[model samples]
Target: MDVEILARIQFAFTIAFHYIYPPLSIGLGLIMVFMEGMYIKTGNKQYEILTRFWLKIFAITFGIGVATGIIMEFEFGTNWAVYSRYVGDIFGSALAAEGLFAFGLESAFLGILLFGWNRVSPKVHFISTIGVFLGSMFSAVWIVVANSWQQTPAGYHIVGEGFNARAEVTDFWAMVFNPSSVDRIIHVWQGAFLAGAFLVLSVHAYYLLKERYVEISKKAFKIALGIATVISLTQLLSGHSSAEVVAENQPAKLAAMEGHYEESGSADLYLFGWVNDETQEVTGLKIPGGLSFMIDQDFEAPVTGLNAFPKEDRPGQVNAVFQFYHIMISIGMFLIGLTLYASYLWWKGRLFEKKWLLKIFAFSVLLPQIANQVGWFAAEMGRQPWIVYGHLRTNEGFSQEVSSNQILFSLILFLVVYAILFLLFIYSVNKKIKHGPYDEAKNPDEFLKYVS
Candidate 1:
């Protein structure tokens, strides 16, 4: 194997493993805000109880997110030194904003939210929760700005000083917006909300079946489920808009996602298919002229395909991209349908009581999160060959100084560490849930038993 290719694969694997927690942090951050708001408004002990419960889960997730994210940034300067140098100016600005604006706010306010439970007034604590919520969303904004710039490559002029591409900002606002940021950000926020919402619903359903914390989990579920319903339905528009942007800006990636091997007008979207590389065609059911409408927003518009690019420049593994895209869309649609059904049942006052629906709800909770990961994988992997589409190829980004053996060694170490972390998180969360929140007790006996 080419050492560089292997390094890229290793980096991708480790980073993908690392990505699992950030969404949870982002999602649960919003959940924390809602839970605290309910506590303040209703003075309901159950809301406070649920807040502490979910906070335990959020603490574990947020810690992991911080730990793993640092490694990804570190790898940029270590394994992908060339890539780091190439987009340093652009990446630097976004990273700096994240540290200055988001990270500091979150870390500081999170302390108050966690440790100030009895130390501070309820109003002050509530405000702290709001602070961290905004900080978490701000973090997503900055991170998305950096990635979106890579996607559409804006506000930069090349300073051709070395083998690495040097990008300096030409327009700060343009860099922030790029071409895909708004749509991508909407989708991202919706996905994070979906994660938090389903988590609440899943846990609530489990508790209802077990007859544990039924009242507490139900209130939490109502807040989460209602928001999830709205976000899941609206996410479709964000997905569609982002797809249109991708089709225009990165036709090669779009073509790969659909397994469109040959240039054609009135292209049909393949719902499921396998691409024959030799024959350059996807064998699947397709809607006539659908691809044209999707890409160009015009049914008759010409939709470019892989053949439009040089054979060497086309994305490899067309079938994989197509399959990933299909899976992502299927799961997303399922979430939309599931949320609508849940909403209807919720109105009918049968959501928690119906055994069949509860079972399905429990299972379906895993899908949105699974779909989120798959959707992200499709977006990133579909953009393969080009690390910064049309500007830099992935092959050009590796550091010659880093050996494959060293990377492999580190990768294995991470697996063991992360495994331990995962176990600890689950154990602690379950412990908290089984024991119930410390504040659930009204009398002295209840408070004393769980407090310390």
Candidate 2:
């Protein structure tokens, strides 16, 4: 209803919609590198075919990612000019580095990766694929660094008074590798890999079900399964490490995430719970001393609670943080189980034969995407009130010149345009999938080899 709330919702909705494609692109980019490299090393035609098929998907996703991302940059000046000005000195350099080291490298070689198959040598094309993957990752690194610095506020200092104050970088490298950057980056990328792997697995499962591209589907599924299993295990570690970092650097956020409202010697981890902010109570299934063990490896060690901090300093959205975090963790555990189950079936040579499992895999493509979004919400929502942790309150970050009607008007337009884009993207990707990877002109024996 109000300007600030409407602006926040508008930004949140647009960012969430835009968020769908980038992780898909990043994850798909890495998968492209792996699949293409396998083709070069093993001289397998199926690997080459798989690479080409997924490359089309990656290109579409990347295009949408770039297009949607530009809107967020514009929103900064339009809706959150004050916040932009305050952090502009730090964000400017990080964004500039992304343009130089990440976007430039990815864009320059992306043409070669997409169309240079027949024009360039195999080795050169393979190198280009690697470059694109690295570039995508580098892009994530700088963006995460800038964001993590906001969470931790390192290597910066305020240089003015009241509304004129802004953060200026004291050490660029320190800002880049701020306390939470490494852990958060690794966690983010692992999640991206899961998204990519799930997409490949889902499409391949569909092919297997339809009895088309059997051999190629099997190969791709196997590759994706391997990556999924390994990454799931690593994600467990990364989540734990990132939580520890949060506990140390953002104790109030940590408290809100677990719905711990009172100071105690040990904290319980909720398996499922509802936080009643009005009553200051958490009601649900919880494991005794679980939070303590998770953070300190001891059941009795102290874990800070929301009540330990002043009411002014605590996160405003305690219930949202708790719910989002638990749901994300639950989905993560389910994914790990599914991956391990699939791996077992594959090992037993029963994977393709199991129609039930194939159906599950087909739908499970969306689970990782859901988990990624919820995890993002947990992190951002948990940091409520503070746009830049201790330095900046979110209420102070809005543009003084912006009006509710203006934001409301733009938000409606964004929804309409994004809806069209989403429909078009699905149609284009589905058409490609239905067409399959066989090109008769390029490979004369394609139909006879796979379709037959």
Candidate 3:
């Protein structure tokens, strides 16, 4: 196989697997804060128990996310030597900011939030949990800002000889607010919220099915479901706005998504289909004028079709974009449906009473995960052929000095290392969850200054 293809596959494989943890951790970080916050506000033992239970899971995900992410950093140097040399100056700054803004805050407070539970006062512990939550989110902001620059290069000028087009940050703030930043950030944050929310609901649902921690799990399910509903809805809106940006800035991608070919009135949106370049149309269910309306806010608006772009400029990986987009929308819709149903059950005071639904929820907690993964695939794959959008192609991003053999070796090494880390993470998390908080080595106030 070709080296570029191997590099792409290797990066995507590792990143996709690694991606699961960060969002889960980010989302769970919020849940940790909320649960602990509730315990503080209400002085409720149930909320405290809930906080203890989920914290184990949070730790598991955080460890895996960090471990997996470290590989990507190395891969940038090993696999994409050329690409790194070109964009390193600009990219390095964002990574550094992430360390400062996100990692700094999270790591600083994490000690207090975790091991300090009994070592500090309730109020102090609660504050530490909140810090962890903010730090996780802050980390997200800098990371997204960096990725945003790749999608829509800004605050930078292209320089250097014909061999490499070096990207340098011209205006720091402008780089942060690239044209696609808001839409991408909102969508990403919402997805993280859903991941966290669904995880809470799913685990609680499992306990509900077993009739364990009945009242407490019920409370968690209601809170998580409610949050999931709101964020899922907002995700839909953000997706719409994001698509609009793609339409204006990356029309070829939009055309590939819609399977539009030939200049036609009122572009149609394919619900599900296979776009055959040879036949020049999608073979499946489609919505007439939906494409045009989505893109231009008018049913009769003109949309550039795939025919308009030369083969070289056209987004080559159309099939992946089409499938991933469909999966993303479908999953988002399902989340809305599930959240609404859960809300109704909660309102009726019959949420946990419905064991069948709880069983479904037990397995469905991973759905947002699927949507999150596919949505990400669509976003990244949709930008195909370009590492820095219009500025440079991905093939051109590699370092001439790097060898495929080295990348292959690193890829194998990454797989082995990640496998071991993941197993340990799962073991530690399950062990902690199973142990429960009913009995602890010390009092909950051991770290807390609270005197009861």
Encode model 1's per-residue lDDT on 1-452: one tens digit a residue: 56577677667766676667777777887888888888899887667777777777787778877887777787788888888888899999998999999988998899998888889998999898888888888899989889888889998899876665688999988899899988898888888888878877777777777776666667777888888889888998989899989987888888888887667666788777787877887888887778887766677878888988887687777777788889988888888888898889899988787877767766666777787777877887778777887888888888878888887787778779878877877787677667765534445464443232
Which ten residues in a row are the worst by lDDT in model 2?
A: 439-448
lDDT of each residue in 58-90, candidate 2, tens digit only: 999999989998999999999999999999999
Q: Itemize residue pairs with steric clashes in candidate 1.
A: none
TM-score of every candidate relative to the true structure: 0.94, 0.98, 0.94
Q: lDDT tens digits, residues 216-282, model 3? A: 6777877788788888888899999998988888877777777787655578987888877777767
User: Model 2: runs farther than 4 Å from truth?
Assistant: 439-441
Residue 103, model 1: lDDT of 86
Taking all chains together, the TM-score of candidate 1 against the true structure is 0.94
Give the candidate number with the greatest TM-score. 2
What shift in Å separates residue 343 of candidate 2 from its native position after superposition?
1.2
